[model samples]
Target: MKLTVVGGGSTYTPELVDGFARLRDTLPVEELVLMDPAQDRLDLVGGLARRILARQDHPGRITTTTDLDQAVDGADAVLLQLRVGGQAAREQDETWPLECGCVGQETTGAGGLAKALRTVPVVLDIADRVRRTNPHAWIIDFTNPVGIVTRALLRAGHKAVGLCNVAIGLQRKFAGLLGVEPPEVHLDHVGLNHLTWETGVRLGGPEGEDVLPGLLTRHGDRIAADLRLPRALLDRLGVVPSYYLRYYYAHDEVVRELGTKPSRAAEVAAMERELLTLYADPSLDGKPALLAERGGAYYSEAAVDLAAALLGGGGTPYQVVNTYNRGTLPFLPDDAVIEVQAAVGAKGASPLPVPSVDPLYAGLMANVTAYEDLALEAALHGGRTRVFRALLSHPLIGQYEYAEALTDRLIAHNREHLAWA
Candidate 1:
């Protein structure tokens, strides 16, 4: 089957290419298209992609282009990984929120809203184009602020599913610690994208034995260390929170730490420069080891598994994905997008039933869902008021004064991207 990657020029592309090469038996991609506006970066990444596939003796053909329509036309599945404003815009997103004494993350808080506003429109336009060219194609979104972007695509009636590496990354980690194969570990992963928790770690299947307690007893410190959270917190909560939760569980501390370090975007920019220089080497046929430090670990495996299942190919029956809640969480609106374990297939993902959620986690999920709803409104129908309201609704930035100031800073830093501004 033919597959397309919209942001194929990203430094992350080589890692994806490596997965496509290694997992050919699962996805069997025949024509892989990497589309990017940055022609120079596209050439470097595209060349490496071709070499990776050839080195593995895979028969898939790799191509690169700047034309969005050409790249998506007739593809079986199209993956969205584009950054609307590049790393420079991300730098702005990661830094300006710090001025308000808040978290400066790209996927949450005020900065996340800014990213959502900038990303949703562009992703919708691409989805529209993809639908026009190939209505049957599935849109697999790997973009940041995935919940908002995927919600926009689904609301606009596009065939789409949102993918994140967090679940897979955690699964791999848990498997290594448990001394079991990756597929043998199943996570009772639930909550919204980025903001999720592993309520249970089951083995064999969704109904298999829950080894979470044993895992905690034996490897709590290691897991807590990896998450940068306190082992006592994990013991008290009795659930493994995603690393993203740190921004919430330790907001002030995170903000203080963020203020001290260079923005993640800046570090990534430097890494990308070095990665590009490495990609320029003709002899480099594999994804560089340095790419692992660039984040999105196991992204390729997640992408491959999701795409394969969506296309009626080989993949795990149950996997974690972001899709319409459809009452998986009794408290969340059915239309709200949630990340959870689901049975994926050609028909799409249906979230598996979840046990009753504690008020602590459910309350936060409900709060963020409301914020996301407002964020989507601002993204779809731009206005200063909408921007302010979304920020004001966020649990991380609930104060009106902070919201108002952040709203102005967001628009100011992103005026060129916001059409209404």
Candidate 2:
């Protein structure tokens, strides 16, 4: 099978390449295309991708191009991992929101809305091109604000499923803690993308015994530390929230802390520079361990599993993915995209039934779903008022004054990306 990676110039490409190389038995790629506009980074990352494949003795031929059409044409599946304005823009997304006394995060709050405005239009255009060239290809989106982007793709009638490493990362961590393989650990991962909670962790199979309580009892401190949340909160919630929840659960404290440190984008920018330098070296064939610090942990495994399942090849039949809720959570609109365990196959991913959520989590999910509706409206139909309304709907920016100020800052900083601005 042939596969395409749209944002192939990203420093994260090698980690993906490494996964394709290591998991050849699952996907068996024949040709891999890396498409990006950034030529220098593309060359560096592409060279490393080739080296990685060769080292693993994978038969797949690697190709690099700046042309989107060429990269996606005749592909079996396409993965979207692009950053619309790159990390420099992300730095702005992660900083300017702080000026409004809000948490400066890339995928939540006003910053996330800014990213959605910048990204959705570009992704839709790319999806249009992909459909024209290869209507049969599945678009696996790994982009941020995935729920919004995936909703856009589905609304526009594209065959797409949103992918995130958070579910897989947590799954792997749980597996390690349980001394089992990653696939054997099924997470009851639910909620919108980035904003999710692990209500259950089952072993052996989806219906297997729940091991979450045991994990919490044994490793709550470590897990809480990893999520940067208090252990007490985990005990009270009786579940683990994704690390992204840190921005919400501890908004003020996080804002205070963000004020004392460089934005994550800045840290990642520096890391990407070093990673690129490493990629430039002809001797580097394997993905560096430092890439772990770059985030998206176990992304390759998730991508491979999802791709293989979607392509109807041999792989895990069930995994956690972001797809239409379809009433799994009756509180959410059926059209709303949610991340949860699903039975993935050639027919596409169908979410498994979730046990009813606690009011504590369900209330937040409902609120965020409403915000997502407004956010997508703003993304699809650009207007300052739409943007303002979207921000106002967000729980994190519910105050009209903060919403108004953030709307202005978002438009001002992203004038070039926002056509209406």
Candidate 3:
């Protein structure tokens, strides 16, 4: 199977490439294609990936190209991972809204809307090209504002999937806290992206042995003992939350007892700065150790080794993201295609649905839903007014007047960023 990575020039390509190389023995992959607008970086990563594959004695040929047609032709799956303006712009996405009194988590609200405005057109163009090239290929999107971009792709009637690991990652983390094996735990969740709440949780043992009552009885008292979350949530809501722990839990009664919200931007900014510093720190050595440390962190391995699964009657129990509601998920709009779980095979994919989210999460997500939806409107019309409306509608924007002012300033600030219609 020919597997193509559309944004092969990403700085994280090395880690992702290592992931693919690690899967050499487990998955049946034949060719690895690196496609990007930046041929120079692709050539560099492509050369290195080929070397790594050969050194491992695996047999997938590596090819790098700037031509979308040349790179994606006859491919089984396409991994879409790109940044329109990199982390600098990402910082702007996050910080600008925080300055405006909005919750700025880098992936929601005005930040997300800004990103969607810039990225949607480029991604849809890729999707359209995929239609003409690999008509039957599965597009696995690993980009941010994934919900927005995937929504747009589905609206345009393309085969695309959004993939975010937060849900599964949360499940596993909670299982660890519960001292149970991962697959043995059952949870009910809903909402979009990082905004979600778990409604029910059951620890599986023998069928009749309900672990929930006993387990919570013994250690449930420790739940959020020092954290902002209420320990009674274990008794009340019935499930542990999976995402937005930092923020949602921050609102627990005890924390809210402080009166006003404390800004954690410095803390969050420090983390981002540290990572950027490390990525840019050329003088730092131990490349091998660093590679090993980050190798498995982002699940790049799962991405790297997908070629064989697509062609050889072998199916990896991994998720292939697509943008289509078509009834696969009951919680989201039917026309939407979220990056939910799915099995990839020669025939294509089938998305699996989980339970709907709680009312709290649904309300939280309602804030961003309009922002996400409006970005699609902006993309389709090249409408600056729509973009303004999206930004104005964010939960953190304080007032519509402020939203309009911010939009006006942003338009003046990012004048060259958009090609106004």
TM-score of each: 0.99, 0.99, 0.76
Q: Which lDDT value does model 1 have at 353?
A: 98
Clashes of each: 0, 0, 10
lDDT per residue, candidate 1, 1-421, as tens digits? 9999999999999999999999999999999999999999999999999999999999999989999999999899999999999999999999999999999989989889999999999999999999999999999999989999999999999999999999999999999999999999999999999999999999999999999999999999999998899999999999999999999999999999999989999999999999999999999999999999999999999999999999999798999999999989999999999999999999999999999999999999999999999999999999999999999999999999999899989999999999999
| Lowest-sum lDDT 10-residue window in model 2 | 312-321
**Highest TM-score against the true fold, candidate:** 1
CA shift of 100, model 1, Å: 1.1
Which residue runs of candidate 1 sit more than 4 Å off their true CA positions? none
Candidate 1, run of 10 with poorest lDDT? 105-114
lDDT of candidate 2 over 1-421, digit per residue (tens): 9999999999999999999999999999999999999999889999999999999899998899999999999999999999999999999999999999998888999999999999999999999999999999999999989999999999899999999988888888888888998878888888889889999998878889998998999999999999999999999999999998888899999999999999999999999999999999999999998898999888998899999999988779788888998889999999999999899999899999899899988999999999999999999889999999999999888999999999999999999998877
lDDT of 3 by residue, 87-181 (tens): 66666665555555554444665666677777888898898998898788877777777888778776777766566655455446557777877
Error of 1 at 116 (Å): 0.5
- Model 3 regions more than 4 Å off: 171-189, 198-237, 245-296, 301-312, 316-323, 327-332, 338-357
In terms of TM-score, how similar is model 1 to the real structure? 0.99
Query: What is model 2's C-alpha RMSD?
Result: 0.9
